[model samples]
Target: MAGDRVRERRTVETMIGMYCRGNHGTSAGLCAECAELRDYAFSRIETCPRRDGRVRCTGCGVHCYNPVMRGRIIAVMRYSGPRMVLHPIMAARHFLP
Candidate 1:
């Protein structure tokens, strides 16, 4: 369970980091908006009823996020997805962590 939480946290952190870097041109840390999203995501993950890291949010097909947050995360993923290739280690770590 602790391992799952770490994995979930790592994955969300990586995604948000990528999104913030790609969109805001900052490699330092998350912006205010992305930070909020990160916090929200972590809260959702920590309280997740499923508790299975193997089944990701998309694969689980569970609409856990609120409508607004869902849309925001989707947009972030869409914007940051293609750019993720450049960060191979981070991308791979997200899956392997």
Candidate 2:
């Protein structure tokens, strides 16, 4: 499970990297959406009940790296059971290359 989570994180990170490169590579390490997500995630971390201080996907047990930034992600996956499973599709729409 941990391995899978790591893989998912890496995949999302890679996608964010590609999105940033395609749009605004010279500005910062992350794009606007990714940054927003990061900020959102950070803001919610203290309040969230997850052990690692992250919002996890109920369906997959995948932790959200930027939970606070994307409300839609949380909303869509709120029914995924124990895991939080923010939609990769949504993240892709806003941040994927």
Candidate 3:
């Protein structure tokens, strides 16, 4: 179970990172994507940090590139397996209009 949890965490971190990067387009490091999502998710909540090496978007409840928060976010998101597979659509629904 612990191994599965670790794997699940990695998977969620990757997926959240990808979503922030906007469907795997040509982007640089997670920082760029983190910045973009920070701007996008800020409206829903204040103080979305892109500089602290971690950014959490309350709108979608996904943590972007923040090692500290990644595991927790993944644990929650993992419950929604289909949603993880359909992350782009799901993220859009939550973070977008």
Candidate 4:
């Protein structure tokens, strides 16, 4: 469970970081848009019912995120997914699964 939470955080950070870097040209952290999404994602992760040993969000098909936030996160993942190969460790830790 602890590891899953860590994995979830790493996944959100990596995706948000990548999205912000490409879309906002920032590398130090997320931009305003991505930051908001990141905060929402972190909150969801913290309260995730499946944290004990769970299916990944993308595959789980759970509607954990609200519609608007879900759309935002999907966009972030789309833009950042291809770029994940660059951050192999973080990608392997959570993003891949």
- Which candidate comes out best when scored by lDDT? 4
Predicted candidate 4 versus true structure: per-residue lDDT over 11-86, tens digit per residue: 7788888788888999698788888989999988888877665676665666899999999888888988787777
Please provide, for model 3 over 12-61, each residue's C-alpha lDDT reduced to its tens digit, 9 standing for 90 to 100: 44555655455455365556544454333333233334323233342334
- Per-candidate TM-scores read 0.80, 0.36, 0.30, 0.85
Lowest lDDT 10-residue stretch of candidate 3: 50-59
Candidate 1's TM-score reads: 0.80
Runs in model 2 with CA error above 4 Å?
31-33, 38-97
Better of 2 and 4 by lDDT: 4
| CA displacement after TM-score superposition, residue 25 of candidate 3 (Å) | 7.4
lDDT of 1 by residue, 1-97 (tens): 7787877677677778887887888879899988999899888887787886667664567789999988878987787667656678756765564
Candidate 4, poorest ten consecutive residues by summed lDDT: 88-97
Evaluated at residue 51, the lDDT of candidate 1 is 80
Enumerate clash totals for all models, in the order shown. 0, 12, 0, 0
Which TM-score value belongs to model 3?
0.30
The collision pairs in model 1 are none
Ranking by TM-score: 4, 1, 2, 3
Which is the better candidate, 1 or 3, if ranked by lDDT? 1
Q: List candidate 3 segments past 4 Å from native.
A: 23-26, 32-97
